[model samples]
Target chain A: MKNTFLNKKNLTWLILGVAFFFLIQLLIQVGVITPYYRVTMYWICLFAILGVSLNVIIGVTGQFSLGHAGFMSIGAYSAAVVLRSMPNLTGLFIGMAIGALISLFVSMVVAIPTLRLKGDYLAIATLGVGEIIRIVILNMKITNGASGISNIPYLISWPLMFFFVFVSIMFSANFKNSAIGRACISIKEDEIASEAMGINTTKYKVMAFMFGALIASLAGALYATTYYVIKPETFGINNSINILVIVVFGGMGSLTGSAVAAIVLGIINNVFQPLAEWRMIIYALALIVIMIFRPQGLLGTSEASLKTIFSLDTYKNALKGLIDLVTLKKFRVAAASTGKGKQR
Target chain B: MLEFLQQMINGLSIGSIYALIALGYTMVYGIIKLINFAHGDMYMIGAYVGMISVTTFKLPFVLALPATMIVTGVLGVVIERIAYRPLRKSTRVAALITAIGVSFFLQNAVSRIMGAKIYTFPPVLDNRTFMFYGLRFNTQQIAIFVTAILLMILLQVIVKKTKVGRAMRSVAVDQDAAKLMGVNVDRTISLTFAIGSSLAAAAGILVGIYYNTINPLMGFAPGLKAFVAAVFGGIGIIPGAMIGGFAIGLIETMVSGYGSTLYKDAVVYVILILVLIIKPSGLLGKNRKEKV
Candidate 1:
């Protein structure tokens, strides 16, 4: 464990991450990053955290969960209720903890039964669970019904948001490389084979699901603290799909991809803000186009590590791909027809 | 007791609409194993078309229903050709996501074109109420039930006795084998989509006339409920979808009548989870052991 943490590559990444964080903080202090942009940054970080956590379930564990926004609502509401009375950093922590606990419990209740189903069935089941959560919240008195809860103190800062984003990405990356993650992947590849090999499929699936729910709740807390109000409408199926889009666009299994996609998509959202009415239409079209052209996603399960980013071979391959695209040479090759074959 | 009977009648009308939509879901799933998330949006389009035909084109009610079905059916075929056919060999999740994208696209596009305001469907059918044994029934309710049953019966005949129906069945059973036997797999799939979409369109018209209000987002809730019905009956089974639809309709009506109206949606979802847990294969589905 010590060797893994103290390795040269790990040390370099840590330094880079800290340096980047400080750089962003310095920019915020200097007023170079305006308040408007800061809000956008907060959203990017929240989406990044959400995408990474959901990646643990969908990409790493190979389970299709569409109820992420439900868990997020739990955190947001719990935090809002707690902070309504306490309105302090300690209260924030307490609220986040409560949210995580509730999400964990709900996820356990949902995952154990639903995980036995596969693919579209699981997706629909989770979607139903999410809708049910939203409906319950909608009818609840404490949530103020459809009007939602307001007067929430904006306690979450840029640093706190960034810290949580970093922690979530780090945790997801480490989990992906761990034994449990491998077990989850094995189950994803073939549940029966993994079960035959003595891996407890249900236990690993439940663990991954719980982990996802926990992180989603934390992000939810951050989200609630950033905004002044929390509404049940915000945590509907559409919001869940929004997070799923980030994960899928980033490349499912890659944490780095999720973060990058979140930032990119967040910027796209900002750019399209003027055309608010057409935003969803364009977003839907983009989803269909991307699925048709590159179903594996932007990175295609490959992480953008320092080694790959800095390597000459990586750029060379990219150049070759570009040339191939322009020349239509790739399409002409019969042997290269399969979509998955071209990923590597 | 009279109120209970009234609720049951109401349930039957609503359940018939659900059955019509569920048939589309089941037929598509039978052929491609996809949930076709956008299937519900087709219902919305159908409603809009029905409204346009009746209000703008000034078509009679009898003619408007067929016009709506034909338009939605063609759109379904076009959607299948453009979005789904390419992803037929891809991952189920990919196809599912694309279906969702299509659904969102359809909803937003229609909303943009039609505006978000709720439009009152023209009361083509006379609002005549019939009373029998202290039970009240409306003409619209009777029309919806009768139209839905006629469509289902027509669908049954087509699927059971026609050449295209045979092709669809064979394709669903084994695509490659059917292809080997000279079945046009692509065309068969397209036809399946067409037929399924038309049924959903009929339901949409029935709903518009029955409810008296139509909106761009109207298809979402009913679509979900219909999907639940499809699963409850056995996702790919025809009779199963029909049975499931009526059962869900009755349950929903009964819940709202007896319990809080707010909990009706929640109750339907709970039923979905319970069905999934208790018998994932559904009421009429045959359990096939997973193969290695």
Candidate 2:
């Protein structure tokens, strides 16, 4: 009877979570929201989706990709070109879905041959692919050459965006709590050990890449349909880097960290409009500072959870505040005594 | 046949500029694994510095050449000290992203200072042509090819013969071991950037002369192509970049001349894809044993 009551309480929390998002959707539909806040929320949702997609590769898999924008470019242009040829609303939805699917297919074809390559080579291969995509699109008559394709489909509405964003975040959260997520983290922690332990590192690596590419393509499709325009330059290295920055700035291996980072960076981007030209400089400085002072990121490798907030307070009090403890802290203190962190 | 020769000449000349810039990527990638995305912007800076030195300071061309190299070299070392040195122990991916950030900062700062408009460099090269069998080699083109080869030889000698070069190779081979051996990894890295930047400076001045104009963002295309070249020649190998540079030049020029020039990047991208799929270690790079 007590267990049944506990299960009922968990069901209520899940329903409440659904209701909270439902309320936000209702507010938008009822026209109680301003366009400014509405647009910002829309971008935040889109980026949050993209950030989680990126987490599969950068955060969990422990690999770097400067080519994510290239995958996105594929989706954006895929949607743009297809919907133009087939403009029925259902056809457009099919196009967005197909566009994302095709991207997964192509990335798999590319990833299959190249994921086996050594460290940083994969990064370069991906980067090269990204550039190739942009350059090829730039020259394509279908893309209007340098002029870019316009009028994709303004048919994408706020409700659609919110629904897709919720689906995206939920998928990522669920992945974090699943076997696939554990497999990715295992590969990241030690590939050799994981392989020795029969984890099939290569399969996990390719799956992670495919999954990341799939989500990124979905984000690209959503962005394309909503904006009703797509330019090759729009999905350049800067887009990939921005996604990466959000991933790292949150926490490299944490899903919730990326969502929070995307939101913060999005707001920062909007607020710091005056620093447009100096944006890279600020980001570079921030990265350097973060690596020096807090390389673990704000959340570390741990995902954010309701219980984590309370655990954090206790952990802080038990270790540093209350009394000294053994373990890595003692080693760190010993290293400090030996003159670590003191520059010559 | 004459037209083919002309394309060859044209490609080799442009290839020289790419080769020169690629030396930076290959050399630094050789010692330190940092991609140094800002290396391209340093080329931009070199152009601006050339503009300032030749036009603003009113110096002779040859003197201004050395002057641009000096200033850009110092700037390269300073960036290493500031942005990268502290993050030395972090993951290579973090360093790569940071390099991109540094790149953005440099490009934007120059963009802000010089404005985004294209600025034409005053004609310092004599810009005359020598014709042979219907193929004409411009003074600038000849200069570019000759100077690039000379720089490659100089780089080869530096890496192969000098004590500093030995130290650099040592650090590249094993940073922790080199540090324990008292090789001063930081200083070697700075020197690597110094030499790399000087080469980029030379490429900048030549390209400025060839194009007769320089823009703030001019660094992006060439920078990327140089990176392509470095990879093509098998990164971390000195002679490979030289060959890769010329190879890229030939492909891009041939494609631009015969096919649609707009698809020039398509040629590079295809090569990149082919190289990665067929030979991940590159044509010249030997496979490294997995580090424990």
Candidate 3:
């Protein structure tokens, strides 16, 4: 009887989650969410997806990559090309899948050879690779080079997008707690230590790179599918910078922080699209401000766990605990040593 | 053979511009280990200053060129003090991010004030062509080469002979040791930026005259290309930057001229991949692992 009651609660939560998503989709579709906010919200959702993807590599794995837009450009162009060739909803799915796979493969090819280098070289190499990809796309015969691929099929709906976002979030969050996640965090903390401990540090780093690229490609695929158009410039160095800012602004290790930063940046980016010439300047300024003022990101490595956010006492204690840790490192040291003494 | 010679001549001019610009990247990278993405934008600003000096200030070509270079050099110092100085001891990534922000801010600020349309810059040299030994040459090309070489020699002298240069070198080798030796590390950094920015500025102005037009986005391609050159030649070495800059110009010019123009990006990337796969330390840079 108790088991049955637990199952019933689980079912109810699942229903509520689905219904909640459906309700939001309905509101947006029927104009209840306001057309004034649709495009901006869409960008937020997409950027949330991108930020989470980047957080996998940049935040969790602690690797500096500058070629994110290269993968994204490939995804976007692949989807755009495929959808242009075949204009069915099924085609959209097929194209996105194919595009994403291709992106994953290419990212592996790039990362495998390059990720071995540390510090400034990786940064430079990734940047070079990104520019190379941009220039290649700019010169390609199929994608129309600098003119950009246009008139892609608009095959995305709000529900479909929401579904993908949910899947990406769920997958990323789950991965964050997995054994692989632990290994990655260990590597990030100390590559030498991790290597000494028999972690295939190179393999794990490559995996993180591939994983981040795959998710970024998926986001890019979705972006291209929805807009029915994408240009090389759209996925150029500046786009890479924007995504980097989001990842940094979100707190590198926190999925929830990544999502929040993405959404906030997305809204701002979309709203300020009218400032076409100075849009990049605004992004740059925002980055400088964020780095100077709030280097840990808005959420600072804290997850938006339901229990933590919902419980008043938990939130207060967590806040107080964090303050204590920051302001009183000596106290933390004393506490740790005392705990060690107790164990002894 | 003659055609190849002409191509080499053309490449030398453009390559020198890249070398000048790469100096900005290499110096900043050597001192602080941060790739100032906005260094290219500083070149753009220099060009604009030169344009204003010539057209608005009504200075002669030579006077305007040096004046613009000085202005740009000053701007570089100001930017270093304002945007980069605070984050000096921070992680390399923080500075890199800040540089990106500064680049965008300057580009946008320029666009907002100058408008988005491509601006026409007045020609500095007469478009006279000279033929020698069945080879044709442009006056502007010759002038570009001469000016760049003169700047290179001047730079070599300053870096090698000057006391400030010695101070700069010491700072590059070990910041702490240099500071302990009574060198003002901050001043050296400022001076490095000033000199490097002036070189880049001169390149920008020279390109404006060579190309006869300027746009806000003009610096991006050359900036990236020059960065690649810095990487190719070994980023911290001045001589390497010069060689790498010319090599890239030749590679680009030859590839674009020989192969379809479309393959330009492919050629460069292919080379980058090959070099990285073979020699990750660059052609000149020695391997120094980051001791994290």
DockQ of 3: 0.27
lDDT of 1 at B191: 95
Interface RMSD to the true structure, each candidate: 4.5, 6.8, 10.0
lDDT over C-alpha atoms for residue A48 of model 3? 85
DockQ of each: 0.52, 0.38, 0.27
Kept native contacts, as fractions per model, are 0.52, 0.40, 0.39
Top lDDT model: 1
**Candidate 1 residue-wise lDDT, A125-172, digit = tens:** 999999999999999998899999998999978778878988888888
- The 10 consecutive residues of candidate 1 chain A with the worst lDDT sum are A335-344
lDDT of 2 at A247: 80
Q: lDDT tens string, model 2, A63-160?
A: 67778988887777777777887876676667678877888887888787778764566777788778877887887887787778887766666667
Q: Model 1 off-target regions past 4 Å?
A: A1-3, A312-344
Q: Write the per-residue lDDT of candidate 3 for residues B1-292, one digit (tens) a residue.
A: 9888887888788888988898888888788777888988988998888888888888988898789889999999999987777666556666677787888888888988998788889876798998998788899988888898899899889989999999989999899999999999999999999999999999988998899888888887788778888888887888888988999889988887777777776677667666666776579978866553
State the lDDT of candidate 1 residue by residue for B1-292, as single tens digits.
Answer: 8899999999999999999999999999999888999999999999999999999999998899899999999999999998888777767888888998999999999999999999999999999998988899898899899999899999999999999999999999999999999999999999999999999999998999989899988988999999999999999899999999999999999999999999999999999988988898899998888877
If scored against the real structure, what TM-score would every candidate get? 0.96, 0.90, 0.90
lDDT of 1 at B81: 90
